[model samples]
Target chain A: MSDAAAQVGLPPVTPEEDHKVSEGKGRAFLGIPVVGWMLIFFGVPYFLLFLQSLWEPTAFGVAHNWTLENYKLVFLGDTLSGNIYIPTLLRSLKVGAMVTICATLLAFPIAYLLAFKISNSRTRLMLYVLVIVPLWASYLLRAYAWKVILGQNGLLGSVLDQLGLENTFLNNLLYSQTAVVITMTHIFTPFMILTIYAVLERLPPSLIEASKDLGVGRMKTFLTLVVPLSLPGVIAGATFTMGLSSGDFVAPQLVGGKNDVMIANQVYSQFGATNNWPLGSAIAFVLLGFVAILVALSTQAEKREQL
Target chain B: MINAESGLTGAPTAGAPAGHAAAVELDNVTKRYGDVMAVEDLDLRVEDGQFLTLLGPSGCGKTTTLRLIGGFEAPNRGEIRIAGDDMSSRPAYKRPVNTVFQQYALFPHLSVSQNVGYGLRHAGVSRSDTAQRVAAMMELMQIPDVGERRPRELSGGQQQRVALARALVMEPKVLLLDEPLGALDYKLRKEMQFELKRIHREVGVTFIYVTHDQEEAMTMSDRIVVMSNGHIEQDASPAEIFDRPLTAFVADFIGDTNIVHGTVTRIDNGHATVDVGPLGEIGGSTDDDLKSGDRVRVSIRPTDVRVEAGAAGEAVVQDSVLVGGHIAMKIASGDETVVAHVARGSSYEPGANVHLHVDSDRIRVFAAAEGA
Candidate 1:
């Protein structure tokens, strides 16, 4: 054969045909199991929940009735008993926003330090391990730990008492919105750090040097070059933090007061003490929808930034 | 003309103006990385509008020297001056110099035009002026149409041009290029070398280029500073370096040459007669004073050695490599092998005995102890 054909090594074939054949068989082999797994674990439950949300809460359990009362009770009720959904969701969203902002602000410098400032690989790995060590502990245990730290007679309260500020600490230190926000920020900050660090680590050092050589100062370089490039990770981190913290039931339950209850706590009460699966499913779907919208918006923003 | 204090001093060339402040000067600059010295006490003066190249092998401190001038690095013991201003403590951004980094380092996020206009924007140039200058630089680089494309979308050569445009558009007092064309393929590298030279001439900015490729340095640099082991081995014009390398390291580094070791038998005026064991006695010019029994090395270019049909001093033809336009024949003279470039059509078979003649005037002798 000719040199061209020899270099190509095989007879010419249409790529689309080859792709179709490989995808038809190979996709079924690999993709079918994953698809089946997702459907079994995620799809079936989610569909059931959606169906349940359309029914009504009965004396014993839920009844098979097509009604919008659950949603109406969720969105339109006036009092806390009539409609705790709006207040709880609004509080959850506020907490999520605060957690996201605080976590991102706290994580950025830490990620920058790990990725760029600390050049020694062992030291960087140690620091990264330090961030991940807290994650290895049980999530519920961590939430409870936050409860002990922020409790009436716990570490913070005793410290405040020693400092002669017992009155201020006794009134609002434990079972407050600040306690929940603080705990949520602390727990979720590592995820943001890891994500942003991953992106920043891949950035070539020469780009920063080039920016400096071009007469841009350190702050400008960070703003114009480093931050823009690390944005996808930032958005991903925000989405993850927002998604996790807003839907979290434990942190709010352990450290939060009645005024600071999140939507997840309401969902839990509906499923447990209230015996209202349909209303619980509706609240869960609302939280899921909100998180989904947030994730979609963030991913879209990240895509636009890339372009 | 060359001195220990001044390193290697060549007479001011046409491109270098008389009695002007050196575009970039390094005085007693020493950069140490922990225990190892990256650049030892070195003195260098790059004249305005002159393309001075730091040409060396890996770990030879060429890139380190470029980084020093660009203010990416500060000397541990000495001073760096740019355009008569002492820049010893100034960071890279504060210094009035820019660098075309190795592998381009073009901003992947920015378009070609934005990347090129980066410095202009930082310099407080208005949008209209930034655009005009960016367009002008792109046109000069012959990449006017690639302004809208991202750096990753461009080919290597195009990326290189964009890098050049970026650095040059800044209108800095000096441009530090750190192996800027090192990433391009051979053909594109050759093309970029000419482009760089043309741009240097057109812009007349002091360009300090770093490269390990000797041919690239010779082709593009007005002057080449050959470095080895964190010190300058030789600094001179490309022709002067090629013709009369100050040390054996420079002779070997610049091109293929026969480094014949010999001991001086006599010194007549400025020339010395040295006994090269296998090649017999050869007369060559020396820069250092030589005694009757001083050891020296003599460098002979391959093209200067003549191989004739008649056998006077017997040499066995070991190999004949048919390079285009000429044949590089390696002949064994006694125990030592001497390479000669003969006309391509010459029919000399391996194992044939051929007579070798050295062009006495073209031989350069250096003190044997000065060899790297």
Candidate 2:
């Protein structure tokens, strides 16, 4: 075998080559579950939804004849409903924007403190658990927990009444767009925090030290070095927050007023009560497309900018 | 001679011309991180326009001392004076020194020009001046064309050049290099050693280098401060360090040596003869007091161990390998293995009787209970 290999000009098989051959098998084995899951669960359903969006709705179910009316109606507006869909979508986007901005503003300082200020590994671990422990609780429970805290007759009203300041704490703080934005922000800020924290933690301390060593002070270092380097994490977290909050229907259903009905709420009504799967799927695809465009834009911005 | 070739005659940025106070001075600096004393009551005076290296093994406080000098870490007790200014309480940005970090730490987001000009921008240099300085520095580092390229896009050697350019552009009072060539391959590191030396002489900036590699220190530094266990073991020139090491640790750590335990049998004039067991007596000169019966440790370099073919010998040749310009041979003497280097033409087969001659003038003797 050795003589044949030498004649063929094949390099002698070394330990490193032997190890790489075994590693290839392990890699393929490790990749199986994700591939299988994405194919079976995500790919099939997403394909069906896309197909349903193109199909025409009939008396029985979706008809074989394809139509663009469902998509056209979404953009052009429904004449009978008096422009409900577009306004609801704009409102959902507004709510998402407000929530994302609020969450980002709230999360950056916390993540910075978590990554830099806290040095003890045990303490950092404890703080990390504290941030993540709230996530393990049911999302519905957390959304409703905001209601218990912010409701007009719930925690705020009682606290105001106890403090003897009735008129000072008045803002129609429940069953409104404000309430919906607040609830969504509360629900989604943790993802932003964790993302930014991970990015900040992986940043080499030497980078910051180098910045300081080069005659840049603390504030300037934060602006130039810290902020720009962590911009990728900001974009990722913002994308996550925007996509999830804009497409979410739970908060609008739970604590939102009638006027707080968003695109997802319209999507739910189309699918559930009306049984209009084609329109529902179209609306769903539209939201997905908008968020996908946003994600693409943010990713492009991230690629174009480097710190 | 090397500086003339680099084309950088006037380093106007090198603050406080050479005849000022020492470039950097540490007055009894002590730093303790919890239980471990990183540095202890260290008083070091780095003269102006000198390439001084803090040479030691890992965890020897070399890096800690550099950090203290650079204001990255404030010493717990003592003053750090840079250009005769007490900068003990000042932050890193306020100091007159800059550091070329161990890993380069070039800003990845910025172009090479931007990274090199970053300090000048903070120093409030005009935009055009910053550009000119950055360009001049890039040219000096031989990386003029890489200005528009990001640090990640450049090769490791180029990145190192960019780091040097960035740190040197501002012409800091003193430059702290924390093993700047450590990340490079052996060949690149050797090339960089000479390059760094040339640039050092050209720029005329006081350089405080930190490295565990003793040979690199010997090659580049005008003064090498040998450190061990958070304290200075020997602060002297490289030649002095190699020839007359102050302690057992300094002798062993600087280079390969055959350290044998022995006792002082005679002290004649300036020389002390040690009674090494089995291998017999070896004579060496010591700077410290040496009694006739005092226990000592002797260090003998491989080059000092002369070899001769003999029928009756105390050592047997175990192996001989041709290593570049010399033949490195291992000889078994009693229970100990002693290495000896001979001429490239010298040949000795395994199990051959070979006599060893250690030069008394080259042997270094130290107290037995010294730094371990």
TM-score of chain A of each: 0.87, 0.87
Instruction: Please state the i-RMS of candidate 2.
Output: 1.8
**Model 1 CA lDDT for position B29:** 89
> Model 2 over residues B65-173: C-alpha lDDT tens digits?
9999888887899888888999967899988898999999999899999999999998899999999999999999998898888899998899999999999997898
Model 2: lDDT of residue A154: 83
TM per candidate: 0.88, 0.91
- CAPRI verdict (incorrect, acceptable, medium, high) for model 1: medium
Measured with DockQ on alpha carbons, how good is candidate 1? Answer: 0.59
Report the C-alpha lDDT of model 1 over A1-307, residue by residue, as the tens digit.
Answer: 3455558897655667667787775565667789999999999999999999999889998779899888888888756657668888988999999999999999999999999999899999999999999999888888888888877788778888888884564558678889898899999999999999999999999999999999999999999999999999999999999999999988888888888889999899999998899989989998999999998999899997777
Tens digits of per-residue lDDT for model 1 on B129-212? 999999999999999898888898899999999999999898888888999888889999898899998898789887889999
Give lDDT tens digits, candidate 2, residues A1-307.
5566779998767767678778785667678899999989999999999899999998768896889989988888766876667777888998999999999999999899999999898998998888888889998998898788778778887888898886444457778888899899888888999999989999999999999999999999999999999988898899999989998899988889888999999999988899999989999999888888998999898888752
Q: What is the lDDT of residue A158 in candidate 1?
A: 82
lDDT (C-alpha, whole model) for all candidates: 0.87, 0.87
Q: How much does each candidate deviate from the true structure in C-alpha RMSD?
A: 7.3, 7.2
